[model samples]
Target: MPVVREFTLPDLGEGLTGAEIIRWLVEVGEVVAVDQPVVEVETAKASVEVPCPYGGVVTARFGAVGEEVPVGAPLVTVAVAASEGDDDAGGSGNVLVGYGTAGHSAAPRRRRVRPVQTRPAAVPAPQPTAQPAPRPARSGPLPVISPLVRRTARELGVDLATVSGSGPDGLILRADVTRAAAAVVSRETSAAAPEPAVAWDDDVVPLRGLRRTVAEKLSRSRREIPDATCWVDADATGLLALKDQLAARAAAPRIGLLPLLARICTAALARHPDLNASVVTEPDGTPTGIRRHRAVHLGFAAQTERGLMVPVVRDAQLLTTEQLAAEMARLTEAARTGSLTPAELTGGTFTLNNYGVFGVDGSTPIINHPEAAMLGVGRIAAKPWVHDGELAVRQVTQLSFTFDHRVCDGGTAGGFLRFVADCVENPGELLRYL
Candidate 1:
């Protein structure tokens, strides 16, 4: 008899306890190789392709697409052929997602797996696609992860104890609870009840995945941080001239406006270090003061097809204009393709948001949580301004700075914003820091 081994979902990223199933790479009764990607999942941090450690016949798969599965929940079961001398048959030596160990190896070969109807005790059985039956009387703590899921169940008034879990070890997933809630509505409706005269046409979108994560983060920021915004109109003619000058140079790296502003930000942060720090809070949300980071892990906003993501450039204060341009370009491409790792998306002392791309003049952006401040750059356009006592059409832009009031008062914030504005007006100001 072939031995059936279960493979559970592993932690995909730092602090990510669960992930939503985006796609399935393997099907039931399919032959799989050890360390082969079995499924694709999206967490709050990033999207990841998780590989299975066991190589054998895939006997069963749990969780449907769009379903959220918690870490350590069973994902799939593989049945490997029993062989002489090997205590664990069809096992893998490599552990990709925190499961499996060395010594066992199985080649990609066909194995006669019993009927799919017979699954291991850990594998979840399929449920009715349309209205699932009410969850039977079960006894145990609800195997649930991700507070978002629990909140969804609670908001929908679905009794989790009565809902059947389609995840390994009967772990309840978001999709399962949603289905159970729908089943309750179906059971309560009367077949003879008259239908609506005209069907409602409103499209309802449930906040999930990245959108939900962003909502929660922004809400937390509003609740925790007593934030304030300061704005300054800057004369950007010098900055644009410098950009032109650099472009005119022989074999100079193509630098964008963002990198130049980023360079200025680093210099400005050096002068006002308080803006480059995060407030430390006790677990119960008690303020313990602020943590000043020596190295500037600069985060910049990158809008992608999925959503808005802030990709951090670590130790950005050490990089020059050319280097910052290169790093920003790489991270922007990764963000567009949804290939950024969790590390690339987090740990920032400050953020730079260029809303100018959208042709916006100004915006009061909510500070990226945990970070003390964010500098918003508006569109640079030709505006009439007094230059050297003469009114001339000069390239001008609005700079909006949002900072945590808890970290610094208006004086420090004004000083930082003024430093950035001066750098924009006189690119020579940055030479002092360089």
Candidate 2:
């Protein structure tokens, strides 16, 4: 008789409530060893592979791909043998030692090694040592490449395996595909068609997943929140000088404008707490009240392959510049690699979108859900401006703030922006607060 056991989904980390099934590694009736990979799940931050805890034949799978499963839900079932020596039927059902019960054995069987025969040395001419067998050739289909590279290859008529991969794990990448396509085009110049002078219709692209979610959130934010945005042209000459001075100092990770911006925003929030609060809707669809969070959890917008993810730096008010930089670096790396947990992506009290990296002057960023306000930072440029009635070139950056009118009035938002500008204009004055 075969023993049967069920395995539940374990919490990956950070108190994640659920995850979406990306793919299943095993199928029913297949025998799997303990700790073998069974399924891949995609959470808010990243995708992780889960392994089986029981060694047995797979009996059933609890969920399918693309299904979101809650924590502690049964994921799969397997059947096992009751005992090795006892063939009798009444010895108790097959119990998986790692999962269902504690009394069952967990040790894996070890293969026995054969002892060398002494008589073989005495044999005439001593038979030649047995040659090691050659490795078996790889069978079935060729390796898989990324979708982007595949599409590019099809359009350019390039062989994927021939291209050298520079990406992680020797996998074919977009750059490699592009270079291969370019080489092909260069070699077959005579076969190329003449460029068309007439304008052609652009292909219609479909929005799904991340892009769709972003569109919905942006629309909802515009419709639900009575947003009031204010832009301020701040003189950051002093801040740049301070940054230069700090960079010269000996430190493991050099601090930059991002951490300084975070510090300034935190201090401004402290001065004007209303800008940090947001309105909450009741379960019945009525306005419950304004929810004010005491601590500042600053969310920084990080653009990733999946979509836009904002990982929060909790308790920003209590951290120093170096600490803030380290946290920002860690969270941003996690976001890029899809390793951020659900909790780290949620529970942000305020958000900041840095469009400066893209060379944009200014943009009114949408407020993340349940957050009262969002701050946008534009490119820092050296522009000629009037200072004390004299023409001078100064470093200027645009700061835009969008706030929920229900939580904070226009006056309060203006005050917060002004305070931030003051800090950026005079970094020396911020030392008092630090």
Candidate 3:
């Protein structure tokens, strides 16, 4: 006899409530060891491998690949072999998504025995008049974490209690609430005159994984934050010369314009710490205050096959230009391969977006939500500029700064932007801070 233990999905971090199963690493009836990865799931943050805490034969799996599983939802059941002297079969002492090994114990496995049937006289069937009993209500907290989902439900006057959840463990998802609201609207519309049907030929690409997350985040940023952009065209000839000088050193690594800009941004942020923070909002989404961070956890925009990802370089204020270049290169590779973890993709105090690679001159970048500001750099091109009181061809680039209005006044924002432009136009200005 073997005791079966059930495992549920665990919270992956960053307030994420659920994950979509990408693929199953283990199948039913397969033997698994403790802490072995059983499935790969894609959360809004990143794609991650979920490990099992129990070591045994997998007896049952709860969700199929492509299905969304909420935190605390049963993922798989494992049957452990009964051991001598112990009344219950024990699980491997492992900690993962849900269960841990502390004071671990197993319950008795209940076996269902089939009843034997014997030949008997013909029996008549009863009339089917009795009504079926209603299904029991599920107990525990509703499977929902996003404040946006709750707000949408409240605005639509949808009763969350009445609607059933399709997510793991009967968790109520935004889709579930949306469907219920649509049903109500449909009934009301049917009561009045029906509208004419339109031809439908457009293809719907189901937004999933990272793409869906990015869409929701950008939408929320637009809806909630009052943001403003300030830009300036700077002469980058000095910055290019500085880069060339650094690259000429025997010990120096290849230097790009981004690392130089990143170093300038960090220095600028130190001078104006207000731009290196996030606004603390009240429950109703009102800005109560701003929380300024001391250390700079810098994030840079990286384009990948999955989609656009901003990988944060932790303790960026402490890293040198060469180190920043190396870290950025590493993260870019991770992003391209979809190997970045949630921790790597999040916790960014400020973001620096370099859209110059796309050959754009300037763009009013949307501030990455929760962060106070973002710095956008455009392509550096040779243009006629005033040098030594004469017009000459010089390297010129545009810098755009977007900031949350609630965080600081325009004057502080302007000062920060001006500092960065000064450093860009004269790389020597950064040496004082260095």
Off by over 4 Å in 3: 84-200, 248-253
- TM-scores of the candidates are 0.82, 0.65, 0.73
Q: Using TM-score as the measure, which candidate wins?
A: 1
lDDT of 3 by residue, 258-330 (tens): 8888899999999999899998988778888889999999999998878899999999999988999999888
lDDT head-to-head 1 vs 2, winner: 1
What tens-digit string does per-residue lDDT give for candidate 2 at 1-434? 65666566665455445666778898766788877878878754456677766777776665546555655555776665655213232222232222222123343222212222222111132223332232222333323233435666787687765776543224454556666776665556635545653333334343433454467667777767778789899988888898888889885578888888898888888888887887888654356789888999999999888788889999998898889988999999998887776567878999988889899999977788778999998999999978779999999999999998888778898999998888999987787776
State the C-alpha lDDT per candidate: 0.80, 0.71, 0.78
Candidate 2 lDDT score at position 91: 20
Off by over 4 Å in 1: 83-154, 159-196, 248-252
Model 1 agreement with the true structure over 1-434: per-residue lDDT tens digits: 66677677764547676778899998877788878889988888878787876777777776778877776666777776555114544355455543333233232221222213455533333433343333453686676544556888999898877877655455566778877777676655634346753333334577767888889989989989999999999999999998988888878778888999999999999999988899999987778989999999999999999989999999999998999999999999998988788889889889999999999999999989999899999999999999999999999999999999999999999999999999999999888888
Q: Specify the poorest-scoring 10-residue window by lDDT in model 1.
A: 107-116
Superposition error at 289 for model 2 (Å) = 2.0
